[model samples]
Structures are given as C-alpha cells and as structure tokens.
Target chain A: MTTASENFDTVGLKQSIEGTFRFRKWRSIAVPFAILGYLIYVFFAFDVAGLASRARPENAAVLLGDFWSYKTHITRDNRSGDVVASVEGERKGTYPAGEGPEWVAMGETTAISLYGDASVQYLPENTAVINVPDFGEITTQVNARAVVLRLPDGKDIPEWMSVSRNRVSIDQGNWRFSMTPARTEVFRYQAGWELFFFTLDSPFYGKSVGELIALAIWEPRVTAEHSNIVAMIDGFWNNKMWRHGDVFWAMGETVLMAFIGTMGAGMIAFPLAFFAASNFAPAVWLRLTCRRLFDFLRGVDGLIWTVILSRAFGPGPMTGSLAILLTDTGTFGKTFSEALENIDNKQVEGIQSTGANMIQRMRFGVIPQVLPLILSQLLYYFESNTRSATVIGALVGGGIGLLLTQAIITQKDWEEVCYYMILVVLTVMIMDTISGWIRKKFIKG
Target chain B: MTAHTVSGTAEYLALVRRRRLYGAILVALFFVLFASGFTVAEDRNAGGFLDGLHRIFDFPKEIFAEAFTNWQNLPRLFVAAIPSLIETLNIAAIATLFGGLLGMALAFLSTRGLALWPRLTPVFRRIMDTMRAVPEIVIALVLIFLLGVGPVPAMIAIAFHTAGALGKLFSEAAENVDLKPVEGLASVGGNWFQRIWFGVMPQVAPNWSSYALLRFEINIRASAILGFVGAGGLGYDLKTALQWGQGKYDQVVAIFAILFLTIMIVDHLSDRARQRLVKGGALV
Candidate 1:
C-alpha cells in the first residue's frame, strides 16, 4: 500500500483527475469569453455602431404603417384652381370626376372627412382649412411665392406642424396635410389595403362582403358582358392595383421551379450515383471524375449558376429551375453515391448467385435498399428548393420574389411586400407539410 | 398439377402483376408530369428550351476565355476580393454563433421534459416554425430597407433562419436525452440552466455542434446570396463585376474561384470535424 505502482497509484490518479478538471473548467470559461471577443470584433467589423445612425426609424415607421393601411391623396393644383382625389396619388387609382368615397365631396368646395372629428376642406383660391379634433380650424393658402398658415387663435407653431415661406405641413400620424406653392395636398390614412380586390372604376369596388355575396347569388348582373359572379371574380382577378392573377401565376412559377429542379436532378443523379458508387463503379477514373464533377457543381454554388444561366436563358422560371437543377444534381450525386456505397453487399451477391444480369441484380437487390433514402432526400430538397427558387427568382426575375423586390425597390407598396411575404411563408409551410407527409407515409411505413 | 397448387400459383402471379402495374403507372405518371412541367416552363420562358440548351455554355465560355486571356491579372483580382470574401465568412460565422446560442435556448424551452415551462412548449415551437418558414432573403430585404445597405442585415437574417432550423434539430436531439442526469441535478438543487448545461448539454453538444456546423455552411451560401440583394459582401462584388460586363470578366472569374475554393475548403474541413466530433463524443 505504501509503494506506488506504475499502473495504479493514488497520487498519479489524483493528479490526472485534478488536471482534467482544471482543463474542463478552463474550457468552460474560455469558450464564452472567446465568443464574446469574436462578437466584439464582429461588432466593429459590421459597423454596428454606425447602424443606428444609418437606420431610418422614420422609413421603418412609414413602411410598417404602409403594411396595414393605405392613404388617399387629395390634391388641389394652385395654377388650375381645381381639386382631385386619388388612391395613393396614382393616375390609375384616380377617382372619376365629381365622384369619390362617401367621406369625400369633390365639388367647388372639396370636403374630406378624416378619422374621428377631423376634416378638411379645399376652398376657393387654393386655400385649405384643416379642422383639428382638439384645436380650432387652421387655414393654409398656397400662393404663387409663399404658403400662408393661419393657426387658431394666433397660436405659435406646434411641433406637429412645420411652416415655411413656401411650404406648410401638418402631420397627425394617421392623416397629414401639406400646402406648397404649386399645390395643396391632404393625405387621409385608412386601415386595411384599399383597392386590393377591385380598382376604383369597377362597380364591385365598394361592396361589402355580404352585399357581394348577395350580388353573386341573386342580385342583377353588375356588368352586361359577364354574370354577376363572373364579374366579381373578373374584377378581383384583373385588379389593376394588386394584380392578383399575376401574383398567383408568379407563385405557381416559383413552385414549379422547385418541383422541376428537384425531380430533374433526382432523375439525373440516380443513374450517376450508380457509376460513382465504389462497389458498382465500372472503373476508377470514372468514379473519381463523377465525384470531382459533383464537387465542382456544388462548389460553384447556385448564385453563380443562376448568373450564368440567366445570361443564356434570360430572366425567367426556366433559368431558375435550371440553376437549381445544376446545383442539386451535384448534391444528389455525392449523397446518393455515398448512400450507394454503404449498401449491404450480401443482397447483391445473393441476387447475382441466381444467375441474374448486372442490371437485373441492381434492379432486384440494390435499388430497394436505397430508394427510400433517395426519395426522402429528393423530397427534402424539393421543399427547400421552393425557398431557393424564390431567391433565384429574385436573381432571374421570375416569380413572387420579383414582385416583392419590385415592390421594395419602388420604396412604396410595402403592403404588397407584406402580402408576398405572407404568401411565401405559407407556400414554404405547405411544401414542408407535403414533404413531411410523403416521408412519413412512404419511407417510414 | 393439383387444383389447390394451381390456384395458389395463379394468385401469386396475379399479385406480382398487380404490383408491376402499379409501378408502371407511377413511372408513367412521373414522366407525364415531367413532360408537362417542362412544356409549361418552355411556354413561359423568354427563350425556347431547345434554343437555350445550346447557348448554356456561351456565357461560361466567354467568361473563361476573357479570364484566361487576362491570366496575369487573375491573381491580383483574387487578392482584391479577399476582404469581401472575409466579410462573407464573418457573416456566416457570427450568424452561426449567435443562432446556435438562440437555438439552444429554444430547444431547451420547447423540449418536453426539459422545458422550464412545459405548457409553453407549443408556443415556442410555433415561434420556431414561423421563424423557419420565412426565407432569409425576406428578412434581409426588409432589414435592408430599415438599415440601408450593410452585412449586418444579412448576418441577422441568416441567424434568424439558423435559429429556427437548429432549434428543430437541437430539440429533436434533446428529446431523446436520458432524464436521469436532469433528475440528479435537480436533486442537488441545480437551476434550470444548470440542469441543462451540466446534465443535458454533455449528452447533446456533439449533435448540436454538428448541426450548427452544417448550418454555418448553409449560412455562408445564404450570406453570399443576401449580398447580391444589397447586403454587401462577396456576392455584391460578384454582382458589380458581372454588371460591368466584358471588361470585368477576370474579376468575375476571380470572385467565383475564391468562392468555390472557400466553399470546398470549408466543406472538407467541416466534414472531417463532424466525423471527429461525433466519434469523440461517442467515446466519451
């Protein structure tokens, strides 16, 4: 007991135990510090400190505001001495002459009823009177050289209102009024996306859900060329502002890109996997070549493939699908070959013993073992590629991604971005569910 | 032959025939769908499939030819792209780090027995699902609108996606963990984080790390893609180079080469690292 043996000794064991504990403790502490240090470095590298200053909280507010609601702009031209109302100030969304929403009366004296008790009136001589909920009436006139603002009771200018020699602006988050030398404008904000289902000119534009249903079921035909129901659908489908038909078509194109890309890759990679698999490869060089080919394809990445393909094919779903096909083919080849290489050899040998040809042996013995794996991978890729297709669509200018980017690029139409985002999320979830279902039903069973 | 044996043989043949018929129908269905999908794609495409097929190599050929003719400039172009490449890698690395931490928390919260508040598991799960469902580009573009243009948005967007994805995997691993260690820790008055860190972490760290590593690989690609959408990285460089047209083909080739090399190297390293981590984890 006193003599310490080489193999077993209390002192040696104690020392080793203490050393391991010290190392473990040191690692536990070092890891967090290392992560923190890296983050600190990344903080500077990403210019995170400047990010706040660079960030536009106002732009974000406008964007978030636009997502749920829209604004109708009523403008009175100073030169013409005339007033007009339009949804979002677009020519296509212009209200017909002397016609507007119930809250608006486009006559010599244009009156606009905003939310709550606030209202606005366009008077003669390009003057505007804004009725505040709490404050008294404020008058603003846009003359040739200056904008005159008359506050209630000679009140000093508030923070909410900005007045200058040529421009006057009053902002109430929901509604705003601005008078310039050239024109006086009022923007009335309302909740919900306006003109989503039907444009201003459509007879079906302002109908309530119940009224629309009644119109479809029993009411007289709104348009002579089409039935009432057909007219409603046509109005919604051909909506100028929202473009529901085009949006749906783009969504479908995105999905189709995924489906065709994944399936096409699978079809190509399946045969290639056999030649690349070590046990089944016809020759060494061929196997290496196939493997290297896969590595090349995968390494090139989809972004490159999309760029290169778009040049030849131009901007379309076809380009996106081909890019995905090219990239996934490499992935499938590598994975499928490895899967093939890992196959149990006894089955193949047993089939061969029955005097079966090589093809027959592969058909009977090899395929069943790997089919489930291959199919599951294909399904998973199919689901993921739906998302990739969206990105690629953005690159290739094809699908819902195109619409989203275009809407974003316009820096207006954030509601469309929100709509497209929702649709993209839903489509991805649906694809996930479908793939999961297939995996469960076919593979697990 | 006996009547009973004859009937049995006939039944067996019928069963085989039915299976064959089903297989044939499935194959035929796939072919039909493939054909129709291709036709639809062709109809909608700017150029016909047949025309585009022959021209697929044209761009690659042009780029490579220009790159080779300017071969002496290739090395310099590659060097110039290194900073952008590093930015891309940093985005991936930082996103993975942050996302992995978030995923650990999400996993712990959503895992049934391991959850601090077991009843809130479904809520956390749905949050993860929603996060997962959003493509990184959506978040990136929105953030770009808010933050102007920078790599930060790309990092955040990728991390968000990585969190949701890694959470799902991490929770799946956590769900299969033995509860004895957790019970042991609780008996000693360890807190929730303590129980997870000391008891469950050792068991699941290897799997979680492996998943995170794979996500890092994916995030690298995502960061590059995000850059193309104005997030500012190598993809941005590549985009500008491509946009410059003929004169900048060498730079385009250089970016592609660097990207290809980085991906290949990282993939190789991670493949090796994952194998080691898993094996070492099992041994311990």
Candidate 2:
C-alpha cells in the first residue's frame, strides 16, 4: 500500500534508535530480575542447619560479673546466737546464731530484695512474727538439716525462692548444726537486740565471701556496709584492668595491618594497571589478560582470603595482612586500569611524536595527569583497608577481635564488650580524620 | 647554520626529557619499603604463607570435585550456609533502603550557595570524614557489643557507612548541576526547595540513581562479611566452612561467581541509564 520509492528522512533516526535499544532494551529488565532470581535460588539452596550447631563463643567478661551474684544465704550461729544474711557480696543485718530461749525478734513480716545482679530475692515467711516496712521481713521455724521454708499462706517456698545452705550461713545465734559436704542446711540459732545493733553499722555489703570474711576479720567497719552498685562498679574497674593490654594491642595491630596492606597492594598493582589499560597496552590479549586477572583477585572477599592465608600461615598477623593486600590489589587494580583507559590519548601521542620511548611517554605524558587520581584511589583503599583488618583479625585469630568474639558469646559481658567496641569506633574515627586530611593535602595538591 | 639547528634540537630534547627522576626516586623508595616488609614477614614466618598461596591456586579444582562427589552431604552444607545467606540479603536490603534515604537528605542539604548554616561546612565535612573512614566491618565489630550480634546491627552499620560515602558523591554531583533553572526560580522568588526540585533535582536525579546503583553493588560485597561477628550472613557460611575444613570450595566459587556477575550486570545497566538520562534532556 505504501510507495516503495518514497524517500524516508526517518532512516538515520531509526537506525540510531534501534542500535541503542539493541544493547539496552531487554537487558535493562532481564538483568536485575535474573540477578534477583539467582540470589533467591542461592538463598533457598543454602544450608542453615549449622546456625545453631556451634555453641556461641563465651563472653568471659559477662560470666565473671554474673556468676553466683544473685543467689545468697542467710545463716545463724548457734554458739554466738547471731544471724546475718549475705546477697551478691553484701551482708544484711546480723543476729545470734540461734534463737535464744524466751526471745522473739520483731520486724516487718514481708521483705523484698533487689539483688545486685539484676535479680530479685524474696523470703515470705508463714508465722508473720517479724515485720519490716518497704523491704521484706519474715520469721519461720528454726531447725537443723534442710527445711523448706513455707510462705505465710501455708504455701511451700518456690524452688526459685529456696535458700539452700550452700548460699546461707549464720554469723551468730543459739542453734544445733550438722555439717555436710554440701552447705545447703539450715541451723537452729538465736540472737536478740544486741545482734541487731551490731549488724546495723556493719560494713559487709559488697565484698565477695572470701574478701568479706577477710575484711570482717581485719576491718569490720569497712566489710559490713558495702552496697551492690559500688560492688558492680568495682567489678567493672577490675575487668578493665585485665582488658587494657588486649584492647590496646588489638587496635594498634588492626590499624597497622590495614595501612601496610593498602600500601603493599597499591605497589603491586600500579605497574600492572598500565598493561591492563587500553591506552597503555595496544595488545588485545594483554589487556584482556590483565583485566581478567584483576577480576579474579577482586572477585573473592578478603575473609575467604584470610581463611586461606591463615591455613597457610598458621593463624597470625602475617596471614591477616596478606589477605588485606591480596584483596585490595584486585580492587585497586581494576580502578587504576579503568582510570588509565580513560586518559587522553592525545597527551601520549604528543610525547610519542617527540620520539619518546614507551617508558618516557608514560613518565611525562601519563604519570603527571593520573598521579592525583592514583593517589586518591590509594587513599580510598587505605580507608577501606582499615575496616578489612578487623574481619581478617577475627578469622585468623589475632587482635582485639579475638577478645571480642570470646566476650560476646562466652560470658555475655555486654558492658565490657561495650567498652572494647567504643575503642574500635574511636580508632576508626581517628583514622578517618587523618586519611581525609592527607587526601586533601597531598592528593588534591 | 645546519649544525646550530641540530644542536638546538638536541638541547630542546634534553630540556623536555620525560623521565621523572623524582618519580623514579619515589618508586625506588616504595620498592624498598615493599622489600623490607616481605623480608620481615618471611623471617618471622615460613613457607606456610607461600604454601597457602599454592593451596589457593589448587583449591577450586580440588574442593569442587570433593564437594560434588559427596553431593549427598549437600544438606549439611546448606544448613550451614542458609542463615548466612539470609543475613547477607538483609544487610544489603537495609543498607540500600536507608542509604537511599540518606542520599536524598544530603542532596537536599547540599546546594553550594543555598545550604543551611554555611559556617558548618567543616563540621559536615568532618562528620562525613569520620563516617566514611570507619569501615563497615569496624563499625559492625564495635556494634556487635552494643546491639548484640545479629543481622540488625550489621545492617545498620552497612547502611550508615555506605550512606556517608554515597552522600558525599551525590553532593558533588548536585553541586555540578546546571544553575540556569535555579536562576529562573530565584527570579520568580521561589523558595529553595521549589527551586531545587524544579531546577536542580531533575538534572542530578539520573546521576544520583546511577551512583546509588553503584553503591548497591558495593553493599552486596560489603554485606557478605557481616557474619564474621555472628551477625548472620554468607560470610558466616564461608567462615565456618573454612574453619571446620569443610572444603566447600565449589559453593564458595559459585557464590563468588554470582556476586561478580551481579555487579557487572548492574554496572552495565547504570552506564546505559546514565547515558540516556544525560543525552535525552530537553535541549534548547
């Protein structure tokens, strides 16, 4: 129906349109979808059974702080007729070891205690003979061996609430005691107003059992009245003492590794990049070879590389550093080659016209123009390498991360872990500032 | 006269001699440093490091063959790698979504002559400097303690660090945008946002998208390591296999292949989109 001889002005526009679409049309949609599908397939095919197989690494910091802090015991001494209670390294009021004849102690019948380790301890007594306000107080039968104390409503004490003999001891009271290897027994002891008065001013609140007893023998005033908050603060300070060396060494080692790795990788890749770039290398095979080599290097993650290196080097800083170097070289090489390819060929040609050799052409024609770019690339990679050092340290087992992984799982020492983490963050912040300053000063110039 | 011309040409050639003696000196110094490092490393260690390189070369073929031969044990391998895979994706998603938001916020915040608190340029620069300086891994390691190890902390770490990086690049692109529309908006007394939305954003939007895509590709690689601290991801799978000597090199290779392919495809797409966006503009 159309005239075949008709001149078509749309010819040029049509060819350009078709050409653009040929490369971009189906690709724009299919590529992302294909990637997503591949990711999903990989995800579905992945094995996750080992997610819970390995027991998490223990946090020693948390364990030391939490171990045996919540459970405590109250005991009375039969000979002296004195009674005293200890919870989380702190002792409460003291009474005679046993109940003396014709004496009944009076205080609040109900008492609630908030233990130092963020747990609650309560003693609900049946008799209602003693009463204490705000806190808890109660009185029950005085017996030997182990007797399960009953609540006020005739209910037996909850297992969670049971105070075994191992956790309790009597300072002074009138009572008979039977000794056993396991200290979960109660004794019949009695004490009166004098015992109460003595306990009121005792400094025994925040010392460990051994420390408390030692202090009671040496300095009664200081041992009898310590608080839980102060005890935790003390614990934190003590842990800090042990951590100082590990944290300092780890941070320094990580930073050093990153710096050296970046430098090493940059040096190796600089010359190779010339061959990789099209402008510098006229040989088709050489450019492809260099490009592919660069791809293989950067394609693998540093962590995997670290594992390989560690197995080869036997778990040390050298393996970690090499991992950083190898991984970074691939990345830097790719970028450097790309930059080289983008350089103006005219400059190189100008030098060539002056009968300059290949090396000379590169020195004056290429190096000056790309020097800033190369430095910038190096600086960026250096910043990136600082982070890689941490992961490398964890895998190969050396640095603060060694301590960090152990602390996160074993002890759950969340707070102490917090301290170590703060140090890493601070170190990174400093590195960043320094790198930025250097980049601006040297690279920009 | 002919002799004089030849002598003059020789003098000019010498004057313009391209070899940079200074550059050569610098290169030599670098070589010294490199040599010293290797020497020290070798003395302290042994052939083990070099042997490892040899093993790496031989790993793919040996490992893949073993893995495939015992394909029935694939379930065990899958079980180990699954959680890590989920974690990696989660990190990538979080980083991409939040980083996108942050990039947008920065684009609005930065406009050379129109930014708020012009005096705070150094402050903004310093903050960005700090953020970009701390690598995601470093951030993740620190955060593992604060937030407890899981995927969430790693995601946040990746998002924020990448945001810091992408935001700076976006700001520079925005700064380079055509100022004509801004002038037109200012002439009509339009507010800053109105002017930017109408004038500047259109120009920079495509560049921003391309940059975002590039960052996303990078985030995929970054997220792969989030699991080293028990944050959960593909990195954990790789770490566990390597640690236990599972030798699942085939799986590792497959993953690497996928990741590489993904990045290449994304890059190709971004380039095409950028070219179209820049060229298809309404021309006068």
Candidate 3:
C-alpha cells in the first residue's frame, strides 16, 4: 500500500509540472501577440496613416537646405531699373550700394554666376535671362502689368518653369528666377552660412583665415580706432546677423537659471529632508505633512509652476529659475529624505556617547555620511536642470531657447535655429562633463 | 616623549585650522555668488521681486474664487478634459514603450562585454550622448514645423530623448550582470541573440523595467509640456483656457486637478511597482 501511494504521488507531481510548462508556453506566445495588438491599436489611434498627408516635405527640404546654405537675392525694381543684392534678403545682410558678391558682375545688367555655366543676368527694364548648360537661354520680361516668358527654340515650356498672367518663374537646379510687374528677382543658392562671422559692412568680411591670423598677430591696424585684433573681436561680438554678444549673454542666463535653481533647491530641501525622514522626525504627522507638501509641489509640474511664476515674476530668467527651484525642491526633498532614512545611525550613537550635544552630534555624524550622496545628487540635478532651463527660457522669453523659438516661429530663419540648436546641445554636454568631473573628484575623494 | 607629543598636537591643530579656513572661504564665495545672482535676476525681471511678492497669491485666489463659484460646472469640465488627458498619457506610454525597446538595443550594443560590435562602442555612446543633449522642445518645435502641431511630433521627440537617457541607465545595470550564465549559454553553442536572451536579459530586466518606469513618469511631464508648445494634449486645452483668463479659470482649475491627480496616482503606482520589481529581483 505504501509503494502504490508513492507511485500515485509521483504521477501527480509530474502532471502539475507539465501543466506549468504548458501555461508558460501559452504565455510566451500570448504576451507578444498582446503587445503587437496594442501597438497596432496605437498606430491607428495616433493616425499614423494620415501623418504622411499632414507632413510637409517641402518645408523639410527648405529647412535642411537653409541649415547649411544661404541664398543671395539679386532683385531689380521694375520701374526704377536698379538692382540690389542681399544675402537671405535680410536688411542686416545686404551688400552696400554699388557692391555685390564676387560671383555677381555689377553693372547696368547684373550677372550672377550660379554653379557651373548656369547663370542669371538681371538686365535693365525688369527683364531677366537664365542660361542653362543643357537648356538654352530662357528670358522673362515684365511688360506693363504682365510677365512674358520666352523659352529656347524647339523646346516647350518645361515643368521647371511656371507662367502666370503677372508672374513667371524658372527653377533651375541651384538657381531660381522670377519676374513680375513690380520686381524681377534671381536667387542664387550657395553653400555655407552667409555673413556668419562678419556682416557685409565689416572691414573683415571676406578675409581668408591666414590673412585674419596675420592681421590679429602682427598686421597693421585694419581700422584706425583700435588694433586689428581688437577691431576684429569687436566686429564679431557686435555682428548684426549672428548677434554673438546677445547670444553669449543668453547662454549665460540659461546657465545662471540652472545654477540658481539647483543650488537654491538643495538649500531649501536639505533641512526639510530631516523632518521628512522617519529616523529623524520626532512626530509621524510632521513627516507625513512634509511628504505631502513635496508631493503637492512635484505634482504641480514645472509647466504649471512656470505659468504661475511668470504671472508673479513676469517673463524672465528669474521666473524660469523660480519654476525650476520649486519643482526640483520637491524632487530633492524626497530623494534626500530617503537617503537620510537609510543612513547607518551607529555613527550618530558614537557621537552621542561622547559629550557632544544634539546639534553637534547630528552635524558630526549625520552630515559626513550623507554629504557625498547629497552633493552628487545636487550636481546631477544641476546638469539636468540646465536642459530644463532652456525649455523654461523659451516659455518665459529668455535665453538661447527664446531665440530658437523665435527663429523657428518666423519659419524663414532656419539657419539661426540650427545655430541655436548647436549652442544648446554643446552647453548641455559641457554641463554634463563638468558635473561628472565634480562628482568624481569630490565624491570619490 | 613629551616634546614629540606636543609637536604632533601642534601640527594636527594647524591642519584642522587650515581646513576650516578653506571651508570658510568656499562658503563665503558661494554666499556671494548667490546674493549677486539674486540681485541681477531681480534687476532683469520685469516686475521687482518686492513688488510681485504680495501679488503672488492674487492670481491663485482669483482662480480659486472663480472655480468655487462655478463648482457645478467643474465636473463637466473635468469630464471634457479626460480625452486630452488620455491622449497625453498615450503619448507618454507610446514614447516609453518605443524608447525602452530602442534603449535596450542601444544598451546591448554599447555595454562593454556584451556589445555586438565592441569596436563601435564609443561611437554608439557618442550618439546616445548627442541624443540626450538635445532638449525635447528643440526637436518638437522643429518637427511641429515639418509635421504640423500634433502628438506624433512630441512622441517622436520624447522617444528619441528617452532612448538616449534610458540607454545609459540600462548599460550601467547590464554592466553589473554576472557573466557566468552568459558563458554557460555560449558553451552550449548558443548564438549571440540566444545567449543574450537566455542570460543577460533575465539578469537586467528587473532593473531595466524600473528605469523605464521612472522614464515613463518623466515622459508624461515632458509630453504635457510639449503640448503647451502646440502639441495636442491637456496642456493645449489648459493654454487655451488660461489665455481666456478670469472667466474660464474654472476650466483651468478642472484641468489642473485632473493633471495633479493623474500625476500623483501614477507616481504612487510606479513607486510601489518599482519597489516590488527591485526587491523581487534581489530575492531571486
């Protein structure tokens, strides 16, 4: 009877094992299928299918091209018959009167060379002629209230040319030409940011690197008022197109916001953490209240805090910093409190065994153990908050983020957007490096 | 013996005094920086700090008063905000899901011992760093220009950032995983994928999930903020209501309540879940 019962028990155990294996096998299949189903649902719910139609590829092309290249506009007044060349058509980048880019031959008829034999000539009387290597000369003239177009012999008007009653436009590979009753314009696309270092009015506008270096080192003064280097520095600093001075100050403000916010939050949260920590607080109610206050502050979110603070502080770096301070205070409070609760406590007892009072004991014992953790956390938050401050700066209308948003909003200043993006990325990376260095040096030491 | 003890004591006292002096200098420097920074910020601000201090509660009081007067409409407004709130949650969820998966791949590819292409580890690391460096608003604003104002742009932007951020954390966890199981699997002639799946993944999944959960919390906040800049979500609605000011403060209140409740609930749930996961991993 004992052998028979043992045999039955073995069979039952084997059956249960097989049952679990089957369940595991089924789950392995079911989980993936469930995840796939959910993703499909999301794909539809997010309207991924309609996204292609909603997306503007042309805008993307414009943005990408504008990032690394600029277009110089050679525009002629229809009635006055005078041609003006401006980079990006901005007032700040306009070439002086009777002057233009080297590629353009300035005279009664301005000839703009656009990449390998394809050129546009802005003749007098609001007339323009575009010559292509493969395609013959295409001429467009503004006649009274209308634009007239003439194509090459034996060739119909190609798709690259668009003709209307009042306007005619031809889009070659890298060059664009358009003629209307009011104005005739030719846009010549060139690689590299135009007037990035020095605007057209600057004496150092088109100097080679070697020449600039020589001038900076030992060459005679380019301008009489100051040395060559000083003048160059002054010119670059006050560059109207790039506004390097303003940009540097904005970057400083962004860093300042992060610095003030993170340090202030640390100062505010460090003391409160003692009250919140279960091991330190004398009463449960006090700890609970502190925890609840932290939750309230954190739950309000930085965006909401920014909104409220902007109302009080108005829009500036101060408002951004205050928002960051309030939000991070809650974060630091929770983390610091947790750190406090986990401390060893033996050291505290050791200090107490000596003739030290409560304040001295807590200071000598509690602080030394937690200082590294606290400082490292503070530094990490400082680095991360630098990025947050950029976004906050945008909302509050300050810093590089403000400039980035403004450039993006204008929809035409994509080059400036690219510049600001690079600056913000570099700033964050530098902060990350600095914080990591500090943490390693101080905490490890 | 008496002379030696006296000299040693003097040296120790001098060291202590020098350390204290350095500490005092550092503290003084910090205080000066803080004070000067405050003054500069106050000066740059449109309203003086003292001027704005009293009016800080004015806006909040007005909002509360209006909300209390329209208490009957509060429930309706709350109900209306539910869809946008869900959309915000969806954006965060989708971003976290996609980002977590990509982050897992990046971690595997970048981790020292487990990297598929160890020679390219630094390249992958640099890529992650660049991705992390870019603020979400920068990408989102640019995408909003290309894709128009929608959650999709915000989702992609946040996911890109999440992948980079979580990848670093995941790799750190993966580095601590024991190599024994991996070697055992390799001895059986298991392929790279199979070995990683059976060995490394089981070791790091718990920690990875904990990090992903934390990222989900952060991404939720990010998505809401992105909405303020034109992405569709509760933030967009909040912006609209807030722009109307005073009269529609009730709507703003309702939105704020929902956002607060959602954030708190999620925070609590994730905290509990992370504790269980981390503890369970330790037990196993």
Output the number of the DockQ-best candidate.
Answer: 3
Instruction: Identify the runs in model 2 with alpha carbons over 4 angstroms from their true place.
Output: A1-245, A345-355, B1-48, B67-90, B110-130, B133-153, B177-196, B228-233, B236-253, B267-284
lDDT of 2 by residue, B193-272 (tens): 79877888788777777777677767877777667556677766566655555555656654544445554565556556
- In angstroms, the error of model 3 at A233 is 1.4
- Residue-wise C-alpha lDDT for candidate 1, range B1-284, written one tens digit per residue: 69999999999999999999999999999999988987897788787777888998999999999999999999999899999999999999999988988998999999999999999999999898878878888889989989989999999999999999999999999999999999999999999889988999999988888888889998899989999989988999988988889999999999999999999999988888899888884312
Ranking by lDDT: 1, 3, 2
Q: Write model 1 residue lDDT over A1-445, tens digit each, in one string.
A: 4464754687789999999899889987998899889889989999999999999988989898999999998888889877788999988899987777788887879999988889999999878999998888999887669988888996788899988899999899889999998988988899999999889999988889999999999988878899998888888898998889999999999999998999999999999988899998999999999999999989898999998888788888888899999999999999999999999989999999999998899899999999999989998899889888888888888888788889888989899999998898899888888879989987961
- lDDT: worst 10-residue window of model 3 chain A: A436-445
Of 2 and 3, the candidate ranking higher by lDDT: 3
Give the Å shift of residue A372 in candidate 2: 1.9
Q: List, residue by residue over A99-133, the lDDT tens digit for candidate 2.
A: 21122232332222222212112222212122223
Interface DockQ of candidate 2: 0.17
Clashes of 3: 0
Give the candidate order by descending DockQ.
3, 1, 2
Candidate 3 is scored at a TM of 0.96
Compared with the true structure, the alpha-carbon lDDT of candidate 2 equals 0.60
Every model's DockQ:
0.75, 0.17, 0.77
Best by TM-score: 3
Candidate 3 per-residue lDDT, tens place, B103-166, comes to: 9999999999999999999998888888898889999999999998888999999999999999
> 2 or 3: which has the higher TM-score?
3
